[model samples]
Target: MMGLRGINRIVIAVRNLEAAKKLYADMLGATFHDAHWTGAPFGIHVSIAWDAGIELCAPMPGREHDSAVSQFLAHKGEGIVTVFFGVDDADVAVSRAISAGYACFHSLDYSQDEMDQHLGGRFCRYQESYVSSADRCGFGVALARIDRKPG
Candidate 1:
Protein backbone atom coordinates (compact mmCIF):
# COMPACT_ATOMS: atom_id res chain seq x y z
CA MET A 1 0.00 0.00 0.00
CA MET A 2 1.23 3.42 -0.94
CA GLY A 3 0.12 5.58 1.91
CA LEU A 4 0.15 9.36 1.72
CA ARG A 5 2.06 11.26 4.38
CA GLY A 6 -0.53 14.00 4.74
CA ILE A 7 -2.23 16.90 3.04
CA ASN A 8 0.53 19.02 1.59
CA ARG A 9 -1.46 21.98 0.35
CA ILE A 10 -4.87 23.06 -0.86
CA VAL A 11 -4.81 24.97 -4.13
CA ILE A 12 -7.46 27.57 -4.77
CA ALA A 13 -8.16 28.90 -8.23
CA VAL A 14 -9.01 32.58 -8.22
CA ARG A 15 -9.63 35.36 -10.71
CA ASN A 16 -7.27 37.70 -8.90
CA LEU A 17 -4.35 36.54 -6.80
CA GLU A 18 -4.01 39.72 -4.73
CA ALA A 19 -7.68 39.78 -3.84
CA ALA A 20 -7.67 36.13 -2.89
CA LYS A 21 -4.56 36.60 -0.73
CA LYS A 22 -6.18 39.49 1.09
CA LEU A 23 -9.33 37.48 1.67
CA TYR A 24 -7.40 34.58 3.13
CA ALA A 25 -5.35 36.92 5.29
CA ASP A 26 -8.37 38.69 6.69
CA MET A 27 -10.46 35.57 7.19
CA LEU A 28 -7.91 32.97 8.20
CA GLY A 29 -4.92 35.08 9.24
CA ALA A 30 -2.90 33.49 6.49
CA THR A 31 0.20 35.39 5.47
CA PHE A 32 1.72 34.88 2.06
CA HIS A 33 5.17 35.97 0.89
CA ASP A 34 5.60 39.19 -0.96
CA ALA A 35 7.14 37.48 -3.96
CA HIS A 36 4.57 35.90 -6.21
CA TRP A 37 5.86 33.13 -8.40
CA THR A 38 4.77 32.54 -11.94
CA GLY A 39 4.20 29.09 -13.31
CA ALA A 40 4.71 30.36 -16.81
CA PRO A 41 4.35 27.00 -18.45
CA PHE A 42 0.97 26.63 -16.81
CA GLY A 43 0.09 30.27 -17.52
CA ILE A 44 -0.64 31.05 -13.89
CA HIS A 45 0.71 33.12 -10.99
CA VAL A 46 1.10 31.25 -7.70
CA SER A 47 1.31 32.44 -4.11
CA ILE A 48 1.64 30.18 -1.13
CA ALA A 49 1.09 30.59 2.57
CA TRP A 50 3.22 27.81 3.97
CA ASP A 51 1.93 28.01 7.52
CA ALA A 52 -1.67 27.89 6.36
CA GLY A 53 -1.01 25.25 3.70
CA ILE A 54 -2.90 27.21 1.10
CA GLU A 55 -1.86 28.12 -2.42
CA LEU A 56 -3.58 30.77 -4.50
CA CYS A 57 -3.38 30.52 -8.26
CA ALA A 58 -4.66 32.74 -11.02
CA PRO A 59 -4.36 32.82 -14.77
CA MET A 60 -1.79 35.14 -16.30
CA PRO A 61 -2.89 38.09 -18.33
CA GLY A 62 -3.70 37.17 -21.96
CA ARG A 63 -3.36 33.46 -21.16
CA GLU A 64 -6.70 32.80 -19.52
CA HIS A 65 -7.55 29.95 -21.87
CA ASP A 66 -4.17 28.28 -21.70
CA SER A 67 -4.24 26.62 -18.28
CA ALA A 68 -6.28 24.33 -16.08
CA VAL A 69 -6.59 26.96 -13.32
CA SER A 70 -8.29 29.41 -15.66
CA GLN A 71 -10.65 26.78 -17.02
CA PHE A 72 -11.51 25.70 -13.48
CA LEU A 73 -12.24 29.27 -12.37
CA ALA A 74 -14.35 29.86 -15.47
CA HIS A 75 -16.38 26.71 -14.92
CA LYS A 76 -16.65 26.49 -11.16
CA GLY A 77 -16.06 30.12 -10.10
CA GLU A 78 -13.21 30.63 -7.54
CA GLY A 79 -12.93 27.62 -5.25
CA ILE A 80 -10.77 24.79 -4.08
CA VAL A 81 -9.10 23.40 -7.15
CA THR A 82 -6.73 20.70 -5.97
CA VAL A 83 -5.79 18.85 -2.80
CA PHE A 84 -2.15 17.91 -2.85
CA PHE A 85 -1.12 14.85 -0.89
CA GLY A 86 2.38 14.45 0.45
CA VAL A 87 3.71 11.00 -0.40
CA ASP A 88 6.92 9.09 0.09
CA ASP A 89 7.20 8.55 -3.59
CA ALA A 90 5.13 10.32 -6.18
CA ASP A 91 5.67 7.64 -8.83
CA VAL A 92 4.36 4.92 -6.57
CA ALA A 93 1.44 7.05 -5.48
CA VAL A 94 0.58 7.81 -9.09
CA SER A 95 0.82 4.15 -9.99
CA ARG A 96 -1.48 3.26 -7.13
CA ALA A 97 -3.93 5.95 -8.15
CA ILE A 98 -3.90 4.66 -11.71
CA SER A 99 -4.44 1.13 -10.52
CA ALA A 100 -7.35 2.38 -8.50
CA GLY A 101 -9.01 3.66 -11.72
CA TYR A 102 -7.90 7.29 -11.50
CA ALA A 103 -6.42 9.03 -14.50
CA CYS A 104 -3.04 10.71 -14.09
CA PHE A 105 -2.86 13.75 -16.33
CA HIS A 106 0.41 15.52 -15.61
CA SER A 107 3.68 14.99 -13.77
CA LEU A 108 6.76 17.00 -12.82
CA ASP A 109 10.12 15.94 -11.42
CA TYR A 110 12.70 18.39 -10.14
CA SER A 111 16.07 17.67 -8.64
CA GLN A 112 17.24 19.37 -5.46
CA ASP A 113 19.78 21.41 -7.39
CA GLU A 114 17.19 22.49 -9.92
CA MET A 115 14.72 23.51 -7.23
CA ASP A 116 17.44 25.27 -5.29
CA GLN A 117 18.23 27.36 -8.31
CA HIS A 118 14.61 28.12 -8.97
CA LEU A 119 13.81 29.01 -5.38
CA GLY A 120 17.03 30.78 -4.51
CA GLY A 121 18.31 27.76 -2.55
CA ARG A 122 15.23 27.37 -0.43
CA PHE A 123 13.38 24.42 -1.95
CA CYS A 124 13.98 20.73 -1.92
CA ARG A 125 13.88 18.01 -4.54
CA TYR A 126 10.29 17.63 -5.70
CA GLN A 127 8.17 15.26 -7.70
CA GLU A 128 4.48 15.47 -8.42
CA SER A 129 1.66 14.01 -10.47
CA TYR A 130 -1.78 15.49 -11.03
CA VAL A 131 -4.68 13.05 -11.07
CA SER A 132 -8.18 13.67 -12.31
CA SER A 133 -10.93 13.55 -9.72
CA ALA A 134 -13.51 16.32 -10.17
CA ASP A 135 -15.96 14.27 -12.20
CA ARG A 136 -16.28 11.74 -9.40
CA CYS A 137 -14.99 13.40 -6.25
CA GLY A 138 -15.63 17.16 -6.72
CA PHE A 139 -11.99 18.28 -6.84
CA GLY A 140 -8.67 17.34 -8.42
CA VAL A 141 -5.96 15.41 -6.57
CA ALA A 142 -2.20 15.66 -6.75
CA LEU A 143 0.54 13.46 -5.30
CA ALA A 144 3.79 15.12 -4.30
CA ARG A 145 7.08 14.10 -2.76
CA ILE A 146 9.44 16.73 -1.40
CA ASP A 147 12.83 15.70 -0.12
CA ARG A 148 14.02 18.39 2.24
CA LYS A 149 17.60 18.85 3.29
CA PRO A 150 18.36 17.66 6.78
CA GLY A 151 19.11 20.21 9.46
Candidate 2:
Protein backbone atom coordinates (compact mmCIF):
# COMPACT_ATOMS: atom_id res chain seq x y z
CA MET A 1 0.00 0.00 0.00
CA MET A 2 1.39 3.35 -1.09
CA GLY A 3 0.25 6.91 -0.35
CA LEU A 4 0.60 10.31 -1.94
CA ARG A 5 3.44 12.42 -0.55
CA GLY A 6 4.48 14.86 -3.26
CA ILE A 7 5.93 14.86 -6.75
CA ASN A 8 9.27 13.10 -6.97
CA ARG A 9 9.70 12.81 -10.74
CA ILE A 10 7.99 12.71 -14.16
CA VAL A 11 8.65 10.43 -17.17
CA ILE A 12 8.47 11.89 -20.68
CA ALA A 13 8.76 9.12 -23.21
CA VAL A 14 10.59 10.15 -26.37
CA ARG A 15 11.43 8.58 -29.69
CA ASN A 16 15.05 9.54 -29.87
CA LEU A 17 16.96 8.63 -26.73
CA GLU A 18 20.21 10.37 -27.57
CA ALA A 19 18.51 13.51 -28.81
CA ALA A 20 16.26 13.73 -25.78
CA LYS A 21 19.18 12.92 -23.48
CA LYS A 22 21.36 15.66 -24.89
CA LEU A 23 18.45 18.09 -24.90
CA TYR A 24 17.51 17.43 -21.27
CA ALA A 25 21.08 16.98 -20.03
CA ASP A 26 22.52 20.06 -21.70
CA MET A 27 19.44 22.23 -21.72
CA LEU A 28 17.60 21.20 -18.55
CA GLY A 29 20.69 20.40 -16.42
CA ALA A 30 19.30 16.97 -15.59
CA THR A 31 21.21 13.71 -15.03
CA PHE A 32 20.56 10.10 -15.98
CA HIS A 33 19.88 7.42 -13.35
CA ASP A 34 22.70 5.32 -14.80
CA ALA A 35 23.77 4.17 -18.24
CA HIS A 36 22.09 0.77 -17.85
CA TRP A 37 18.33 1.52 -17.94
CA THR A 38 18.31 3.52 -21.15
CA GLY A 39 16.25 1.10 -23.25
CA ALA A 40 14.50 -0.84 -20.54
CA PRO A 41 10.75 -0.46 -19.90
CA PHE A 42 10.97 -0.34 -16.10
CA GLY A 43 13.92 2.07 -16.13
CA ILE A 44 14.39 5.76 -16.76
CA HIS A 45 17.07 8.03 -18.24
CA VAL A 46 16.73 11.26 -16.30
CA SER A 47 16.16 11.83 -12.54
CA ILE A 48 15.05 15.20 -11.20
CA ALA A 49 14.95 16.08 -7.53
CA TRP A 50 11.63 17.97 -7.27
CA ASP A 51 10.45 18.24 -10.85
CA ALA A 52 9.17 16.02 -13.66
CA GLY A 53 11.15 12.98 -14.91
CA ILE A 54 11.51 13.08 -18.71
CA GLU A 55 12.08 9.53 -19.96
CA LEU A 56 13.05 9.13 -23.60
CA CYS A 57 11.98 5.47 -23.68
CA ALA A 58 13.24 3.82 -26.85
CA PRO A 59 11.12 1.48 -28.96
CA MET A 60 13.49 -1.41 -28.44
CA PRO A 61 13.32 -4.64 -30.50
CA GLY A 62 9.78 -5.80 -31.37
CA ARG A 63 8.37 -2.62 -29.86
CA GLU A 64 9.33 -0.35 -32.74
CA HIS A 65 6.85 2.31 -33.96
CA ASP A 66 3.89 0.38 -32.54
CA SER A 67 4.08 0.60 -28.80
CA ALA A 68 2.76 3.05 -26.24
CA VAL A 69 5.91 5.10 -26.62
CA SER A 70 5.61 4.87 -30.38
CA GLN A 71 1.97 5.93 -30.27
CA PHE A 72 2.98 8.93 -28.17
CA LEU A 73 5.67 9.72 -30.67
CA ALA A 74 3.32 9.41 -33.61
CA HIS A 75 0.62 11.53 -32.02
CA LYS A 76 2.62 14.16 -30.19
CA GLY A 77 5.83 13.76 -32.19
CA GLU A 78 8.20 13.03 -29.28
CA GLY A 79 7.84 14.45 -25.77
CA ILE A 80 6.48 13.49 -22.33
CA VAL A 81 4.02 10.65 -22.45
CA THR A 82 4.01 9.21 -18.92
CA VAL A 83 4.17 11.08 -15.61
CA PHE A 84 5.30 9.24 -12.40
CA PHE A 85 3.97 10.79 -9.21
CA GLY A 86 5.79 10.37 -5.92
CA VAL A 87 3.37 8.92 -3.40
CA ASP A 88 3.43 6.94 -0.14
CA ASP A 89 0.90 4.05 -0.27
CA ALA A 90 0.43 3.21 -3.97
CA ASP A 91 -2.25 0.56 -3.52
CA VAL A 92 -4.20 2.73 -1.15
CA ALA A 93 -3.86 5.76 -3.38
CA VAL A 94 -4.93 3.83 -6.45
CA SER A 95 -7.91 2.43 -4.64
CA ARG A 96 -8.91 5.83 -3.32
CA ALA A 97 -8.36 7.53 -6.68
CA ILE A 98 -10.31 4.85 -8.53
CA SER A 99 -13.09 5.17 -6.02
CA ALA A 100 -12.95 8.89 -6.79
CA GLY A 101 -13.19 8.14 -10.56
CA TYR A 102 -9.55 8.07 -11.74
CA ALA A 103 -8.35 5.19 -13.92
CA CYS A 104 -5.17 3.28 -13.03
CA PHE A 105 -2.44 3.04 -15.66
CA HIS A 106 -0.36 0.54 -13.73
CA SER A 107 1.66 -0.16 -10.54
CA LEU A 108 5.35 -0.86 -9.94
CA ASP A 109 7.37 -2.52 -7.12
CA TYR A 110 11.14 -2.48 -7.48
CA SER A 111 14.21 -1.23 -5.66
CA GLN A 112 15.11 2.22 -6.96
CA ASP A 113 18.80 1.48 -6.64
CA GLU A 114 18.36 -1.83 -8.41
CA MET A 115 16.37 -0.15 -11.19
CA ASP A 116 15.12 3.46 -11.66
CA GLN A 117 17.50 4.75 -8.91
CA HIS A 118 16.00 8.15 -8.12
CA LEU A 119 15.97 8.03 -4.30
CA GLY A 120 14.42 4.58 -4.78
CA GLY A 121 10.96 6.14 -5.10
CA ARG A 122 8.23 3.80 -6.38
CA PHE A 123 5.33 5.31 -8.36
CA CYS A 124 2.12 4.97 -10.42
CA ARG A 125 0.16 6.93 -13.04
CA TYR A 126 -3.51 7.77 -13.52
CA GLN A 127 -5.41 8.61 -16.69
CA GLU A 128 -6.16 11.99 -15.24
CA SER A 129 -5.74 14.93 -17.59
CA TYR A 130 -2.70 17.23 -17.55
CA VAL A 131 -1.94 20.09 -19.92
CA SER A 132 1.55 19.39 -21.12
CA SER A 133 3.54 22.39 -22.26
CA ALA A 134 1.96 21.44 -25.62
CA ASP A 135 -1.62 21.58 -24.37
CA ARG A 136 -2.39 18.26 -26.03
CA CYS A 137 -5.26 16.96 -23.86
CA GLY A 138 -6.34 20.27 -22.40
CA PHE A 139 -4.99 17.70 -19.93
CA GLY A 140 -3.00 14.88 -21.35
CA VAL A 141 -1.94 11.88 -19.13
CA ALA A 142 -2.66 14.06 -16.09
CA LEU A 143 -1.24 13.55 -12.60
CA ALA A 144 0.93 10.57 -11.73
CA ARG A 145 -0.27 9.43 -8.29
CA ILE A 146 2.92 8.37 -6.50
CA ASP A 147 4.57 7.50 -3.20
CA ARG A 148 7.86 8.85 -1.89
CA LYS A 149 8.84 5.46 -0.42
CA PRO A 150 12.55 4.71 -0.68
CA GLY A 151 13.00 2.06 -3.32
**CA lDDT, every model vs. true structure:** 0.82, 0.50
* Local lDDT at 93 for model 1: 94
Per-residue lDDT over 1-151 for candidate 2, one digit per residue giving the tens place of the 0 to 100 score = 5555554455566655676667878887866543324335533333333432554565655666565466666776765555545445455655665676566554445444543353433432222223232243322333444334445
RMSD of candidate 1 to the truth, in angstroms, is: 2.1
Candidate 1 off by > 4 Å: 34-38
Instruction: Give model 1's clash tally.
Output: 0
Question: Residue pairs in steric clash, candidate 1?
Answer: none
> What TM-score does structure 1 among the candidates reach?
0.87
Candidate 1 overall Cα lDDT vs. reference? Answer: 0.82
Q: Point out where model 2 deviates above 4 Å.
A: 1-3, 34-52, 111-151
Global Cα lDDT for candidate 2: 0.50
Instruction: Give lDDT tens digits, candidate 1, residues 1-151.
Output: 6767999899989888899999999999998863344376788888888779898888888888877587787778999999999999787899899999999998988767677766555567778889988888899899988666666
Question: In candidate 2, how many Å is residue 32 off?
Answer: 1.1
